[model samples]
Target chain A: MKNTIETSDRPVTITIPEPEYPLHTLSVLVNNKPGVLARIAQVFSRRGYNIESLVVSPAAEMDFSRMTIGARGEESGLDQIKAQCNKLIDVISCYDHTDDAVVSKELALVKISVGASSRGEALQIAEHFGCKTLDLAPESLVFMVTGDSGKLDAMVGMMQKFGIVELVRTGKVVMTRGNGLT
Target chain B: MNAEPRDGAQTLLKCLEAGGIEVMFGYSGGAALPIFDALETAGTKIKFVLARHEQGATHMADGYARATGKPACVLVTSGPGAGNTITGIMTAHMDSVPMVIISGQQVTWMLGKDAFQEADIFGITMPIVKHSYLVKDAADIPRVTKEAIYLATSGRPGPVLIDMPKNISQGPCDAPLDAEIDLPGYNPEKAYEIDSKDVEAVAAALAKSERPLILAGHGAMLAHAGPELKELAETARIPVCNTLLGKGIFDETHELALGMLGMHGTAYANKAVCEADLIFNIGSRFDDRIIGQPDKFGKNATIIHVDIDPSEMGKMIQPDLKIVGDAKVVLAELNKHIKALPTESWLATLDGYKKRFPLSYKIQGGLKMQHVLDVWDRLTESNSIVATDVGQHQMWSAQFNKSKAPWNWISSGGAGTMGFGFPAAIGAQLGRPDDVVIAVVGDGGFQMTLCELATAVLQKLPLKILVLNNHFLGMVRQWQELFFDNRTSGVDLEGNPDFVKLAEAYGAKGFQIKRPADIEKVLTRALEYTDGPCLINCEVVKEDNVFPMIPAGAALEDMITEKPKHRMEKPTGST
Candidate 1:
């Protein structure tokens, strides 16, 4: 603590504690311009973060786009990423959505080749998860599923035993439950 | 053809003229033909300096920017022209010099086809640039130019690259010249916001600590925090040690000034840092060269880190208190509320260290670099702007050439780029026409950008080129000798062009100093050459190592103050 050359009555200790978080979900808004994705990706890649999942779509405004990014990092690194993203000229805003009340969803189209004995089991599993059958064949099937990321993960986990030929899923996208921006 | 050519090239020149850019450096090529054509007709206000190489052009602009505290301009063609400027751009980027580089590209349709004279300069310079634009549409020229200048020169200044394809610059377009700028995400004004409570916290730290020090860096120079720092340091009685880039922010002769700290820093400065209980770091990031062992640096102290960039806040040594604002603004506010500390005992203790381990050189060493620099310093008592290339001379000049003006010392601090000194001196001379500028270079490093002698001669800049010619890559050779068992390789410059004759060939004055007695006289003669730029090759001793060295990755406490008398007895260098 730095006291006055004359005074010795008061002193101070300074501390700015930064907490760590297990996961960071960031919502970003940027101009609907070219090369925005590459710009945003640079921020994460430079910090050694593999953006585990990313979903981008046109926002309500015609000239803007919204992006949802999911990555695992501590608070400092996450703050740094958001700060750098905001520094970009094209970016309008970047905010952490991890601690907000929101509705999130992911969509997946899964193709699986089931043997005759496992065919009925696969269909039953699909039916339980409320997946719509996109295509059906004697030995193969494609199903479209929409749900929260956890539900999709669970469904995909159970169907893995059936030997999924291919799986493509949209990354998680979120909107606040009430009258607030994601 | 259409009713009218869009003519973005004319508009680009007009915008640059409106931006108040008086001069620019560049090389003409195929992709840039349109801009050059526009320049030939439209550039009544701008003076363009033709550089032989793009790299030299970039560094020249860098030095101009640093000297004038304004955004300098550069223009280069696509492909190799743009590629050559990477080192210069990164150097300016690291040192936070404000510059805008306009690079021409092939037509838009040919962009990714590996067309002749094409390179992905936009992507190449992204990491190094403050911002970049591909500028596909000619209509966006005015707005982008304004925004690029604003972004480059404002908050935490850096180089901004604008890559213009041939189609956009040459083809017809009808964008208006006057345009308003808007960047929703960029907030430069935030750096000026300082809360009173934050200032109070800083005051409290100064009050409570028994021993405190101010670790100044290049950012301090950027913020122009010299007067405020002087007031506060005088008010608070804190000793200060600057980083390499932070060299000229504070007057080095002040009682509170502990020269520089880190590798190749003063022994007294390093010693003072290890014993301090509180560290007030302003503007300078904790670079590896400055803070060797990250965890150990300021380990015993409470650190308050102040920077304009928020992201720089926990990037290195985690601060006990982080205040995000310009150092100038923050220090001014802190000075208002903070009471001066009772640091008499602390000052006395540091003064003892200074007395015990002062920076010294052996006077009898055969033609020492230190002797040349020290003599030059005494001979020219004026505060000349010193730009230096990386080498033993660079370090020695930093130690010896004591300039008092803020922002007078320009060097490639972070990039450690050679070939920077000579052209940078040219740029500085151009910017500061009244002030003397000296380029302290090494024999090995001088050859890298000596091609710019033509540009220097044409400009007739009153630049003093001091080449400490040792006939070897002395810094590397010193490393090989100290750490690698003296097995030097690939460092001998056996066929160097006679530098004096070379300078004369370029239509400038030249001088050579071979003995200790000649250093002052030759350096004086070099300074007296007002007709044009001059080069002085001071042939100094080889195999000399910079002492008071905290070897790479070593903590401040472990810095060696002297070279061993027995060569074999030197401390084993870290591999």
Candidate 2:
């Protein structure tokens, strides 16, 4: 349904700039309880902010879990969201990858329909992207790839010409690269 | 002095009463059996209505909230039970109705392992609900429950979820009943602080502009500022245009009132909005639907947007003056700053346009939806509440019926959910038992949740339902006929059940109006019998279309004023 409210005729476009540096991830420790995720989400939702990717799992210790959240917002909006998360009782700690040393990886599986003419080209593209063939059906090939979300997105975009039949992505899952597991 | 050991379930019942929740709608399932068991043993004051389906439970809660303006609660089991409530949650969210949805999850230890009937209820509902939480510790139940209710009813109201694990419900905890939840940044009444200079600039623009228009939104209804808005518009003698969600805020029959605006808006209303010199927007988010192609919208006018949320000020289309403040307070202050101006010439210009494109329907030979709205106008008091489902019927109700009071027209505006009318009417009826409550639904929309008729019948609530039986998804078919080469796909209802029989099955009186002559008599009979719920199914022409339509992607000035020659080829009976 539409609103018939009058408005100004002049076109106004506000272009939000991309981050100055490469995108980063955050590892957040929160209470593994009901509503904790919601509380964390409320911090973003109430501000009309959007999270690019989020993955939640149990932490090394019981009664606690970790969520790897990826987002791109203006500096102040991001700061406000992080501060809001810190105030929730269930949240133990939050670390921005830009400020702290962390490791992030994303996994994706792509099924491509390849005819005889495109089979070799599709395989070549997969090898170029370091993707392994998971399944080789008579008419299709499934490739499994793991990397940062951006790299995976690029790989998917490159393979679109081969006629992607299906795509499944396990969103960005991150940890502290090595030796440090919180 | 040792009291009987209380389980988490009993404690939950105690907390519910303490939190002032009088009732809940839910069904019993394996995961939620513990709570039901506790209810049986504890003999709590809270009443639980057993719903046939989880969706029904959520709809009941939605109705209760709409009626009472309080957060009504619903309970469901883990996994599929919880998943079934998503559509209703989305409906409530889209309509901005307040509700607290509680779903039982698997035991805490088995949460991530894909246990029986286990699903990520919180994650699944994240986008739909206002806020969703999973309660891990039994001790935090009281605080979470209180906070959920508080959050659901506060701000731009919507659904909130509380997913409790089975173990938490059966666990032991010692927490005070008044465990305060100090949510550091939680402030429900936070209004955006608008700059004084912006307000002054808008006031100056309004003072100077000869053809200033006032546009109201759902925010105006939320703030209960309808009276203040009407006063400001009438005092300033400015024309008022309303969003679909903002309908009924101003008397549609008023001289200054321009009918609902947007894609399906009347020609005169859309023309006025598009051509105004200065537009004062109050408590509305300028959604894309209202301002089609923002770049070309309101090019001739200056927009002054006033909203409580600061981000909404320039989120979509930029405004000339952006003021972030409570709509009521802002309108009252704007009223104080400006004196009544003579808009006789502007009114005359609009009146001429209104006369050129007056809203009317042919009274040829059979029952028509417009005729039903006309009867509704005569039968219902000014304060009567009218709820509508999403379809061509909803548009008809908005266009043909006259609403004099704010909130009297309840509908799923943003979401456009089909099954909202029946339950919302029940809620509105329950909210104000002294006033008449009517549900205006289409044949397709009425069937979406016709089971709610049992809720009204069992509760002995008097809700009059007027179903426009076009035997097709009227709106979709209209679009298909107009834009899609008339290739009707999944729009026709070939084998639908008899609605009168369906009403009879629910123990409600049913009236069928098949001819133009039967409209007044059938409506009078339905209005006369006020003992229980009733349904009036008016079998309108199956191919009838809503006219004066602005085709999709078309500007307001380019509306289809007359029905196409092909559509008029068949002389379908009308009223």
TM-score attained by model 1: 0.93
Q: How displaced is residue B211 in candidate 2, in Å?
A: 1.3
DockQ of 2: 0.05
lDDT of each: 0.86, 0.77
The residue-by-residue lDDT of candidate 1 on A76-160, one tens digit each, is 6777898889877789888888899988888999877675777899999999999999998887789999998889978877776
Give stretches of model 2 more than 4 Å off: A1-182, B1-6, B18-20, B37-47, B192-197, B564-575
Tens digit of lDDT per residue, candidate 2, span B416-532?
778878877876676677778889999888888887788879878778999899889999998778756788999998887888888899899889999988888888888888889
Tens digits of lDDT, candidate 1, B1-575: 33334487878888887887778899999999998898886645788999889999999999998788877789999999999999999999888899999999999999999999899999888788888989998989999998888988889999999899999999876777778986776888989989888889888988999899999988888899999999988988999999888887888888999988888988888888899999999998888888878878999999999999877887778999989999999998898876678899999999999899887898796899988888877877738899999988888888888757686888898899989988888899999999889999998878999999999999988899988999999988887787667889888999998999999999989888989988777887887889998899888887688988887877889788776554544433332
